[model samples]
Target: MAYLFSGDGGDSDSAVVPLVCLQPFPLLLFASVPVCFILSAALVMMMKVPAFCYWFGCLFCAGMSAEMKAMAMTILYVCCISFLSFSLCIISLLWVFCSVFSAFFLCFFWVLLIVRDCLVFVWGAKIQSETCSLDSP
Candidate 1:
């Protein structure tokens, strides 16, 4: 039977088994970024601060995750409307410069966050050793 031979056909959807599937830590940590961003946005909104940056970051994480899963078409489908809204702002000349600057800042922050999370994972033992050394010193 096809089911017996293919073992449920789960692999049909995924072109390749993800690196995340191999090492669970990175996947779990990466997936949590969106949740953190969303929660931070909620907190900021509660405190009456602007929450756009946090929301943008959450969207970026979701988009990136979709892209990572070899779903470029899906990402395009979902993010197209948001991208059009941004383009309209640029076209209408409403806070165009500010939008560009904010986009750059968000990109920088995302890079930093990813590096921080990855470094925390990669050099965890080294960080612990250094912290212990500092405390003793």
Candidate 2:
């Protein structure tokens, strides 16, 4: 999560340690966007309700944050609205707007959990490898 990444101890040893590149991790998350989109889109194709669409929209937002470009971010916003529209239709069908909103909040929480764990794993591995390299030399 951005919070964990911005936390105090995260960058403490960076004076001596190397920072990882931004390319591939963002790309990997980018590649996953289509899959999420397709799955949510499929739910729409199947005429399922809005909750699924909302959840997928959150995923799409999380993916877009990985991109550094303003244009890509704009495209992501458009995609989000499309997905939300479908989700809203579903919510209307079931007459459960409150429940759908709660689930949407929970989806965001999980996305944060995923981002935090991934950063911890990646930075921890890098630090371990650097320590090993120094010790071996």
lDDT of 1: 0.48
Task: Give the clashing residue pairs of candidate 2, or none.
Answer: 1-115, 1-116, 50-87, 50-90
Reference-based lDDT, residue 101, model 2? 49
- RMSD in angstroms between candidate 2 and the native structure over all alpha carbons: 22.1
Residues 40-133, model 1: lDDT tens digits: 4544343342333344454553545533534543454345445545544444453445456555765665566567556656798898888999
User: Residues 14-49, candidate 2, lDDT per residue (tens digit)?
Assistant: 212122221334444446556766766664453333
lDDT, residue 114, candidate 2: 67
Off by over 4 Å in 1: 1-94, 125-137
Provide TM-scores for the models.
Answer: 0.25, 0.31
Worst 10 residues of 1 by lDDT: 1-10
- lDDT scores of the candidates, listed in order: 0.48, 0.52
lDDT for 62 in candidate 1 is 51
